[model samples]
Target: MRLFIEVPVWLGDTIMASVAVENVMTHFKGAEVVVFGSKVATEVYKAHPSVSSVEVDESKQSKNRWQWLYQKTKTLGEFDLAVSFRRQWSTRFLLWCVNARQKARYRRLDKASIHQVKRYNDFAAHVLGVALPLGDLVLPFAPHSFARPTLGLNPGATYGSAKRWYPEEFAKVAIALSSTHDIVIFGGPSEQDIALEIETLLHEAHVTNVQNLAGKTTIAQLCAYIGGLAWFITNDSGPLHVSAAYKVNTVAIFGPTMNTETHGWHNPNERIVKLDLPCQPCMKRVCPLGHHACMRGVKAKDVLDKIALLA
Candidate 1:
């Protein structure tokens, strides 16, 4: 069978959707899957064993987006089944334009609370007309081996400052763990400055076994490097989910976002570190109230304590 899957646009959502995609792949054994999404999101499936190809969407950049999308969908020919994990009108339009014998698109559930992974899985099960157990977040990159244990610090939260913990706190965690484990800082292009600040703090403390890898890695390289970590300390960001996909022992710092809804799905090794603040779950791009106490209240010691337990 040939399957066309439209993954979510964000890096984290794309990873979470892997659970559903894996289930669909298992149900239709030996199905050749083709994924379409943003460049960053599509990268998650580039190394997937079940995926035949990944097409990065460029319609957003085109002068005539609908025309571009129509042309793009036309060139793909036909698929046995097409599924979209997104609820946007554009995705619905794509589902209509694509030539598939069967098609499915996500519909929001009325449940009070549901993890993103479970929601995606429920959608897949609904499409398949049967229930199945949830699957792991799938990334097929081989883990890199290090001579000494390595600790990864991800201080970048693309959502906003509301979701980010302090870089100083992250550096403190790195300094404490640096005695036994090599420290590697991870971030995207927009987060390079924050990663650099953490690196600077570590250097000021005379920590030499540290690598600042912000803005230096492709999504694939990030997966390979993160797959090898003995431990990962991160904000609720894309890399946090990436670490979960690899089953890396992780300390996920949460602030403005709701952990219950977006925390690592079915990863026993992952631990969430968050303060139960009234202002939490605000889900704002920036903190509504001037003080970002939701994030500020969480100390490096809190994260380190969780890592200690995981260790």
Candidate 2:
């Protein structure tokens, strides 16, 4: 059998949606699985050994993107089944264009899921006519040669500034942890400035073992780096989910997002640091009110306490 899976576009959602993709591969071990997604999305599946092939959709232009995808992915051949974990019209249009005999999609825009991992797993279960248990967000174990017991700091949240913890606070945490653990700061190309600020702060504090990998590593490299960390401290972002998926001891700082829905899925060792402000979990890219108390109220000491407890 041949299977084509449309992955989620967002980085964290793709990581959470990997649970269903893994199920599809497991139930049909002999079937070929082709995943269609963006660069980050495709990279998630590419890192997994279970996926047969990955088709990347690099068209960033909004005007003719769907048409471009339709033309580009029309040659995916025939598939026995196809499932789209995403609900957007473009993905649905691409699903229609794919030459798959069986097609399924999750369409719950009116309703919000308690958690997205459950949403993905439930979608796969509905399609397969069996209850697929939500399991670990599994990725290939990558070995890194960094001999020191390392602590990873992810200072950027792609969602926006509302979800980000203070960079200086992250630097403070690094300075505290750097006494015993070598610190590695991680970030995307867009987040290089934030990472640099943290690096500068660490250097000013006389913590010399810190390395800023922002803009230098790809998503695959970031995953490998997270896999080898003794601990990962991050905002509620993609790397948080990646570290949690890898079962790394993770401390996730949440502010404007729903912690219940987006916290590290199925990872018991994960600790979420957040302030219980009334305006919290606003679900906005930028905080609506002038005060970002939800994030601002969470102290560096609070995160350090969580890390100490993990020890």
Candidate 3:
């Protein structure tokens, strides 16, 4: 049997959806899975045992995007089943266009506080007519080994600046941890500036054992490197989820987003540091009010304390 799966666009969401993907693959045992999604999001399944191929969905770049997607999806031969983790209208159209014996797409449950991992698992369970147990975030990569003990710092939150903690605070944590571990700063192209700021702060503090890897790593490299970390200090972002997949001890600093819904899935080593302000979880790209007290109230000490307890 063959399966067609369209994952979510965001890297973090794709990681969270891995549990459902795994469940479906297991149920259809030995099915050759073909994944479709953004280039970055598709990387999560590249190393999966059941996935035969991955297609990057570049529909947005086409002149007639929907038509392009329909044409693109039609080229692939018939599949036994197709599943989509996205709820967009285009996804509905894509499922309709594809030549598949059966089709399933994720539908939001009435429960307000369902974690994303469970929601995806529930979607897969509903489609397969069984109760599926949630699994750990799956990123099948070779374990990375570093010469010295390494601590990772990720200060970028792709959702928006409102979710990001201060770079100076990240730098402070790096400096404190530097005495015992080498610092590895992680970020994507858009986060290079934030990574550089942290690097500068670390250097100014006379910490030399640091590598600024912002914008230099592919998604695979990011996974491998994060998988090797002794500890991770990051805002709620893609890398944090990556760390969780590898079971890396992680300290996730939450700002505008709700931790209850999006926190790392099935990772006992993960610790969340956030302020319980009444105005928290505004869920805005930018802070609505001028003051970002939701993030500002969270101090570097708060993160360090969490790490201390986790250690």
Highest lDDT: give the candidate number.
3
Q: Roughly what TM-score does model 2 have, to 2 decimal places?
A: 0.95
What are the per-residue Cα lDDT tens digits for candidate 3 across 149-230? Answer: 8999999988899998999999988899899999999999999999999999999999999999999998999999999999
Q: Between prediction 2 and prediction 3, which has the larger TM-score?
A: 3
Model 3 residue 45 CA deviation in Å: 1.4
Q: Which lDDT tens digits does candidate 1 get at residues 59-120?
A: 99999988989999998989999999999999989999999999999976548788889999
Sort the candidates on TM-score, descending order: 3, 1, 2
| Cα RMSD of predicted structure 3 | 1.0
Better of 1 and 2 by TM-score: 1
lDDT of 3: 0.91
- For model 2, how does the per-residue alpha-carbon lDDT over 87-187 read when each residue is reduced to its tens digit? 88777787788888889887653276478788788778888898887888866647465788999999899879998888899988888889789999999
Q: State in Å the error of residue 193, model 3.
A: 0.5
Poorest stretch of ten by lDDT in candidate 1: 107-116
Q: Assess each prediction's global lDDT (C-alpha) against the native.
A: 0.90, 0.86, 0.91
Pairs that collide, model 2 = none
| Deviation (Å) of 211 in candidate 2 | 0.1
RMSD of each: 1.2, 1.7, 1.0
| Predicted structure 2: lDDT | 0.86
**Number of clashes in every candidate structure?**
0, 0, 0
